[model samples]
Target chain A: MSTYRVVPAGSVFDRFAKHIFILPGLGVLVALVIYPTYYLIRLALSNFDLTFMTKPVFIGLGNFIQILSDTYFWGALGNTLVMASIAVALEFVFGLGMALLLNEDLRGGRIIKSLLIVPMMIPPVVVGLNFKLIFDQFGPLNDLLQRLGVSCVDWLGNPLMAKVSVILADVWQWSSFMFIIFLAGLQAIPQYLYDSAKVDGASGWRTFRFITWPMLVPSATVALTFRVMDALKIFDVVYMVTSGGPSFSTEVLSLYIYRTGFRFGTLGYASAVAVIMLILLTAIIEVIIKETRLGKRLEWE
Target chain B: MKVKSKYVKHCLHYMLICSALVFYLFPIYWLIITSLKFPGDVTASPVVWFTTKLTLDNYRLLFGHTGALWGAKQYVGRSFLPSIAPYITNSIMIGVLSSGFGLLLGALLAYGIVRFRIGGSRLYNWLLSLRMIPPVVVAIPMFTVFRTLGLIDTWWAVASAHLLMSIPFSTLLLIGFFSDIPGDIMEAALLDGCTNLGAFSRVVLPLAAPGLVAVFIIAFLTSWNELLIANVLTTTAKAQTFPVYTTSFAQVERGTAWGPAAAGGVIGMVPMLISSFYIQRYLVRGLTMGAVKE
Candidate 1:
């Protein structure tokens, strides 16, 4: 039983000692993240196309000019925004509905919740493949349609339907995610509020409108912020299912950047595309965080 | 009449849940059924709902057992890329390596921020914002940087890229969890003459072990499910992960091979499905990054 000795609290060494703890993480973060991001911004400003050179030549926003002029850039950006909004909207509706239903006191509720979340947990590529199988011209989706006395639709081949298919697959894969978040939000509402509402003779819809909806706002905003950011970065499912195909109809920003960078080896131009995405991503996040009042809430917390 | 109406409402509620369940479950069910079906039955028109005759040919092909399936047995030896076993191994290795690095550095950073109150909420917010930085933004520059360093196509390079992902996530999560940890315990440890590092390792670490496990799972799964970095980074099976390998089957020149690809899809998804059941609560908490707690 050796007696323990305490280190001095306000010693000069303590100040420097904190930096030791900070350095390991800070070093890696700087090396792997900060430097790379810095390099990316620099590369974005250069004629850094790997196909043409061993070293990136500084061109001072030539790549940005190129990106602005490129028709595909605008197309891809429009597609990304559309896909994100459509998928997120559908997911919210379906997810909120399911969350409400699941919130009820029901038999095997936990099991059902777990099963529902399976889609969200599976790999995106696998989700893409499963949807591809389902939407095959001769597949079960068409089979179900035919059985309903409807003509079979070419779900992935037709341009409009292909976009719909991509969104459908995204919704299928993530609505459960929204469901879980909404369920958590719903559950987090104190039972006493409902009890007080009941004592006030508040009707079901009115209670929901006055009490539940407001209570859910925080979680809803959090969920939507996460969903929108994730949806905007849609790449895996698109790459897996359509490869941004039927003539680039589903070519979202990430997929187009990936094609431009990797396949064509135009790293400079691709970096420019990525920098724009990064800016947009930052702006979207900033807006959402502010609009949701989440930043303030977080600060107070 | 009142009781009957209430019963009918309950029935409708159950029906709605059941329909949602089917819509969610059918694709998974289809993948499994398709994986079990023979190659010929996979693309069979008027879609075979169920099959009486199932074959393991897809799984066999996945395991490089193509001696009899293809007439030229020699082609079997060269069938390296499509082999499912290595891809699974690669995925597991990358997942483990990335998570290991991620959790180590993340836990350390989180402890520093929490105990030292370094930068306070601002630091935490800055770290969380790092997560919003799209991987595509850094991918190309990172690619060129790694290429210069001669780390391109290496497992370490891929793991390092994924490490960037997991750090912010785990750090943010642990910060939330650490805030919940009673501060008096750390003060007690400090007064007991344990150094700050000692307090973290012996005191806070044991308390936060479950959270670390949860973060590891999240980090591992995120890395496991990623395709773009793996696709761009690794050119060969040596470092390419399961998602990247499985993706090749979807875009094969000969046309998509439905049966084997379905088998791979089933195989790829199984581990996640199994792990998800155990992590459901942790997952929700992690998914929100402790932004909205349960």
Candidate 2:
């Protein structure tokens, strides 16, 4: 048997060894992230518009107040919330279904699973552009629609349809992510439970509900957490496809922030928006962690 | 009857799998076909599914290649607004270097935390949290910081931004790998006249190589796919990454040249697709372990 022990408390040199090993990584993080985060908060409180000012003027909560009053900000927030929730919900359901299907003793299951992940691995920008081409007015999708005897619809031009287009593209790319996570969870379920359930004459649905679903909750929670974060911060796809156009209808929070900071040269206001997003995400994640007990599951050594 | 129903279920399962395969493969197939289509064929209404006339004009234009082998398409060289070679090279550099540095820093951090208990579990959580922080938030401040350091439009700046996400992820993942290494082996090595560094280099490193490679691949993919930081931080051709370069093809002002844009998309996607297939097994472990084991 092998004994496991922490490096024993020892001389100054030993203690220094640990610190020395850790410093390079932690130092880079502090200089890059911690320091900038502090500066971000400061910028949020100031008037740092590059268009008019050479230096940021401390304006306290001026930028936040401006953001609160701006209907565009509210619209972007609403769009982000809608996009994230809808996309994540759809991804979960479809991914769960796919995972269950793939778990069946079907020939070529491995290949199918591997092929499914291709969409998620492709660059998000390409995903947006790929969907853009597909959703073009004279593109294949609309052509298919016309052939199906349905009137051609403006996939990326109409506001409601544009939002749907973005969401569908997102779901297409990310459902595989959810599938992979769910498949792992499904595989990890002990077979004896299913065997006993079968012996008791339970239906497939019943077996899944009673045995599989509960066991897969941890992975589901994990998947949901990742999808929610990614969806909330969606930028590349929206920016590529629509650029938040059709009268600012599809402008997501991140896209809005990017435009404000980089396009409009309003760094201070953008920083405020960014800060608010961070806080909002943190609060939402905290609630999720509490509800799912996900934090408790971390075996962070 | 039950057996018949089970056969039906299997058929349905296979049907679903085929649908998924089509759904995933269609866009990629379309990108290839569209890239090969001539400019006029690309824009034809009722969307040309199969092009009667194929041309390498788009690829030639995008690459600024005037090779005689391409014949007439070679004559259309330098017509494309910008060549994609610089962007591709920049992305490759950023991906390779960031993943490289990220693995080094992450391994060191993971080893310290796992072996010596550097900052407890809280530090681990903090690192994971950094990955979740919206890149836009960091980009706002870091933009100015990079501007000050004269690092804007530089590969190092882009790589540094990518390191933000990759280092934390690589560390979290490597911590998992390092923790699995039997402590007794390290102790045995220590007793056999090996220093801590010597044990890591001689034993732990060799054992952890596979995991390290997996971490590097994941880091590379993450950096490769990243767009927001690269877009914000790099203002010039020198550091404009592939994703950013691809987006230029679809810029709203330009009316989207579909054939060439599709070519760019295919160019950007091929490496990722190939590499993702190679690392498919490790993908689940990397994603789930990082998420669940935290």
Candidate 3:
């Protein structure tokens, strides 16, 4: 029998060597995450009976209930869901459309394809700043709308328009991502698909329904799941554009947590909000990825 | 009959393409027109207003100068060229260093995990779960940690913070890339008397070059455009990135300057556009990994 055994007799020595490479990253994760996360939970759950900073009275789940019932929290959640659903849904449709379009045999198509991706490259803050300026009453959008004799609606002031503005801005930036993925998916679809569909005399819409939709579902699922997850956590534009203002009409869950924790010095309450949001975002993302064929299928046309 | 059907499909396809173009192109046109006009015309004229003086003032202010918006003048200097120079340098340095170092680390960690099977497959998957938490959730906790580490207000601090997100991304990308390489080649290399590391560096790395470039560009963009944790971690101009520098254009007292901010926005698009021009093939290949593996 070989003297060099699997466990190597010295178990600790073997284990340590086995994972020598994993250490540096794991160590950093500990420093950056584990300790602070511990402190965050501690700060949230422990009651400072003596002083805000002082020693311990344990009040379990008090903060959780407080936040759960809080009107502001509910309002933020509602706003967040609306934006996420609208944004994700629209991006899916637009992305699918672009993907299909780019699939066509067009001339100099590559140049336009490249131009389409430029919006996604700009920084989010610059995006927010640019859109904010553009949405202003005197901004070009209003200027053009007025020239056409249409009413110049307040793009960022009204609650519905604010949500629409933020969602539209996001769609502009990320539709390209959706486009890119769908293009890849469409190409992967064996060309025999069309040849056979043609043999059967299926109409364009019918071929798409039978071939494209079924095959493209996985990519569509991915694009939808990704955008939905990301949209839940929107903060930047809502912050710079409206500051979730005109009396909190635009506030989302992430923005609310920021205001409560950093702005209001309610660290304990804010931590509770953060924990809830973390759980919610992960759970929703998991459900979407699982329920849809996104994670399970490689049928992929 | 088939040819006639194809003709109709082409017509429908062109219509769909036009609508998509209209949706994508309109906002960019709006952005350009707004940036060109003077501040006075911005509010006074209804949509599609023209600038009496179509000035490059916004671009000039972003490059350097003040009162155009983001007020680089008071801090960087009065000069138009050097005022925004520090922010430009910092953005470039931080973006390049973090991306370069991240690719190196991602390669090593990916190799260790994939080849050695150092931990369970579940553990590898769990490592990727870290990114799903979203940056906003982790921002405060990281801010506290970076503060404690005395990493606040340095390029290293921002870069390290970026690693929290990028490492997972690059590592997962690598896993997919590695999985695409034929196992038989690796085994053959081993039989040919090459050590594990030797085969990895020689065979696996080259095969995955397209993937590496794609992941590197993606990683570079992630760090370059990140602003949330960046806003808190870096206090001064020396540490601030491009996004933060552009924020200085939001001056309320003088009313926000569109020109400089828009100019800065346009400048920020350079790295991404220029990158796409050359490495376009590598990018799509990188993004569509495992999706098309033979």
On lDDT, the leading prediction is 2
Query: Interface root-mean-square deviation for each candidate?
Result: 2.2, 2.6, 4.7
What value does DockQ give for candidate 1?
0.65
How far off is residue B90 in model 2, in Å?
A: 0.7
**lDDT tens digits, residues A182-232, model 2?**
998898888999999999999988998899999998899889887887889
What's the residue-level lDDT of B178 in candidate 3? 79
1 or 2, greater by DockQ: 1
**lDDT per residue as tens, model 3, B1-294:** 999998998899778777777767766665676567665554454343444566766666555544634323353323433356678788888877777766776777776676666555455535545656766667666665676778888999888778776676676678668767887787777567555556678999999998888788877887888877777678888899887776666534223455555666667767876787655554443433323321
Off by more than 4 A, model 1: A1-16, A296-301, B66-81, B253-256
lDDT of 1 by residue, A177-262 (tens): 89999999999999999999999999989998999899988888888988998999998889877989888899999999988888
Cα lDDT over the full model 2 = 0.83
Interface RMSD measured for model 3: 4.7
- Tell me the deviation in Å of residue B201 in model 2: 1.6
Candidate 2 per-residue C-alpha lDDT over B1-294 given as tens digits, one digit per residue, 9 for 90 to 100: 999998998788778878878877898888889988866678788678876588877787788765552344344325555888999899999999999998998888888787776676567557756767888998999998888889999999999888898888888888878877998788888667565666777988899998888889878988888999999999889899999888776764322477788888889887776677667777876765466531
- TM-score for candidate 2 (chain B): 0.91
Ranking by TM-score: 2, 1, 3
Q: What is the TM-score of chain A in candidate 3?
A: 0.87
Tens-digit lDDT track for model 1 on B168-236? 788778877787789878888878766777788899889988888888988999999988888788888
TM-score of each: 0.94, 0.95, 0.86
Per-prediction tally of clashes: 0, 0, 13
